[model samples]
Target: MKIHLRSSLLCIGLLVLTACQSTSSPSQNNSAKPHEIAALFNQSTPEYKPETEANRTDKNIDSDITSDSKPIVYDDLWQEVIANLAFDIVPTPRLQKRIDWYLKQPDYLLKVNKRAKPYLFHITQKIKQKGLPMDMVLLPFVESDFRPKVHSSQSAVGIWQLMDSTAYHFGVTTDEWYDGRQDVLASTDAALDYLVYLYQRFNGDWLHALAAYNTGEGRVKKAIRQSKKQGKQGYFWQLKLPSETADYVPKLLALSYLLQAKHPKFKVPKLPNYALTSEVDFAQRFDFSVLASLTGVSKNQLHRLNPGYLQHQSAPEGPHKILLPLTEKQLWQSEFFQRYFSQTYTVVKNDTFYGLARRFNTSVNTLMALNNKQTTLLKVGEVLKIKKAQPLDNLMLEYQVSPYLAQEEKKPVLTMEHEYIIQNGDSLWEISKQFNVPVKDLLTWNNLKSSSLLKPGKKLVLHLPRPAKTPKKPEPKKFLSELEQLVKPNTSP
Candidate 1:
């Protein structure tokens, strides 16, 4: 009877187990099974979706966490920047002072954030790809407040504030038509290359690299050597540096710290993670006015987006790439774009590729390729297509001048041309001081080098600003002292 009871009980247990398996949800069943649990572990992780406005909140930004408890990949570009911050700056008076200064001017930060939206994604992406510290992304903010076309009194140009020599050393070309220093794409690459080189040169010390970036590497090395001689390890903070260099690193550190803190009063302006601008390269030189018309983007906007182009048109040679709003990328690929911009000329007697190329402001190779010709030979009456170069005046009236171009326009044109012959013992410095111009400008104006020996009687061309007449101050009314008053009468008139 006991054996019979045991068998019945065992059968009941098996029946119960089967019933549970049948009634349980799939998820429950999976959780119960060992193999299913292993499969769950092997499953691919969920892909990150860009945060939507509905899902993004102040709490999400501050905590970087979702309601369901998943760590947010990124709520926006700012969040991404914050996540990648690798610096741990100890609080110092200078750092606190900078932080305090930034905190007081919340509006300034907002303005910079707004200006940075169009560029932050590209800059951040480059920094990420290079495995650089996120601090480098804010370097432009410190350099030029993110102004791509800004120039400093020290001759540093562009958002990177790259000096002329540094820009040239990094293969950034400058000419009357184009200044690569103002080209965000070219200058960013050059700046990062320089920073990486400095980082490596300083034995992987980022602070030292940054300081070297502010003041030259030679100065930083000298400071380090001086510190070492004084029986101290050469850290950036430990070494004595110029007031500017000392404040520079602290400012960067302060910015990084404040940004990471997620303060309520100081919020980073909302900018999407996606690129705001897309660079489109043309096969030949293109006109900005034509681009503006084609994309329905204003001329001012086009100029702001492509400040590298000094004039209304792109460089005659190449780098015919222009940054347009990413939304306009589709316009470039549309059939109408090609049909509208394309121009054709009928070949006449004695028509040659070279002549047509010169006439069209393009290259012979480009002309031949456009016409699908294997050789430079041209046949009469054959229609060959070319890119249209629009007239500047026709489009200049369509839109207001961009702030970048307006600043250029407002500059006092140095119209007065002067020819100065070098005198004996006249140094470039002395000549520059006498002319009230920079020595660098003197070198550039004369196509002379800093090391070039100035010879007597050598002529130098200078474009000086029109001299302003100084109003002579009326002679101060003569006042007689008490003793003089007693000695002589003073005129009241």
Candidate 2:
């Protein structure tokens, strides 16, 4: 009787488990599973529809997260970034004074803070990467006020205020493709590295090193000597220094203090954390216009990301880089940089693939690639196609694309013509030797009939040769008779 009771109990337990499983996931039960049935029984479950799962997956697949659906402008991003920035840990007295100066200068103060906040955040992000202090970003405001194209009276430029020599020393290029001085990101890296060097050299006394940055180590040493002579304590402030150097560190500190004190008054924006996309080499000198034309991006867009470029074109300097927007870069990759660069023009009767290549300043091989054909054979009436001219690639030594005429690689003849403004103590002989042009040519070019008189701002065209066509119509024989008389006089004599 007891054995019969236990069998009945087992049967009852199996029935209960099956009931729970079906209750938990009735929609998921194509396969018979005991545990699944128990889970289904424990909770009220939403209907599991295969159609809904398929739809959800499809929705995720169709979504585009790389790019914004709507057009995004600087103003939209600027507002958020500026509102979130805060500066709170400055304590140097001179720095506080400088901060006071910044806060008081309404025109400079408000404009720089607003424009600089985003770039500062960018700097901070990079600093965080190297485990450095984020406050260093504020130093640029004192250096250049976040201006990308400012040239100092002392000859520093860009946001970091790097001198040309210093930039080159740091391996930053000053070619047509890029100017490290004006590039916000590159300049920041170089500046930070330089500062790190200075900090190490000066035993972490940032003030003395910063002063040395402006006035040089020799000047700083002189200041130290002067300070010791006067029996002063501490390093920079107690020492006598150049006015610019005296104020440099204080200026940095003041801005930091103001940001700390008035962070709420300051508007900081949030920048999206964008991963670097593609780093394709620009093996040729390329114009920013070409990138704009090819990528369907505006020149303005390129400028914002690449401020270091002094001009519209990039030096196809090997390793010339462009940090592209992720989605745009992806699109170009998908097309293998072919869509915009793949433009086609058909050959006319006068067309040889060589001629087409020359017209576009590309090679015959490149043209062949465009047409997907091998061999230079041409039919009298066979249609041929070619890529468009790309001058940007001209800067690259290896750029194979060229018009057939350009394949000959005509070396450029650089002719420099200068207009010499007569200065306080200058002479034609001196000017001719200085410019390496013949004195006779210089005088003739300028028509300097008077040997000694050159007024200031007088336009003197030098180094010009006489035209092959004619010499200034020789004082048109004002006298046909005089001319005859002068010729006949020789016979009379």
The top-ranked prediction according to TM-score is 1
Q: How accurate is candidate 2 locally (lDDT)?
A: 0.50
**Model 1 over residues 301-323: C-alpha lDDT tens digits?**
98778777766766668667777
Q: What is the lDDT of residue 129 in candidate 2?
A: 37
Model 2 C-alpha lDDT per residue in residues 1-493, reported as the tens digit of each score:
0000001111112323333211111112122233332222222222211321010000111123233333123333333222222222324444556655655564555566555643554565444333233346667766765767666656576778887656654445565435676767677766765554454444444566678777775678777778778875435557777787777866765554554455454343344443333334566556665666656667677766676664555654533566454444464444435533445454456567778777767898977876778787666656555554344444323335546534644432222234567776777777878877887887786666646586766657553321233111122233222223212322444
What is the alpha-carbon lDDT of model 1 when measured against the actual structure?
A: 0.63
lDDT of each: 0.63, 0.50
In angstroms, give how far residue 409 of model 1 lies from its true place. 14
Worst 10 residues of 2 by lDDT: 1-10
- Judge candidate 2 at residue 190 and give its lDDT: 64
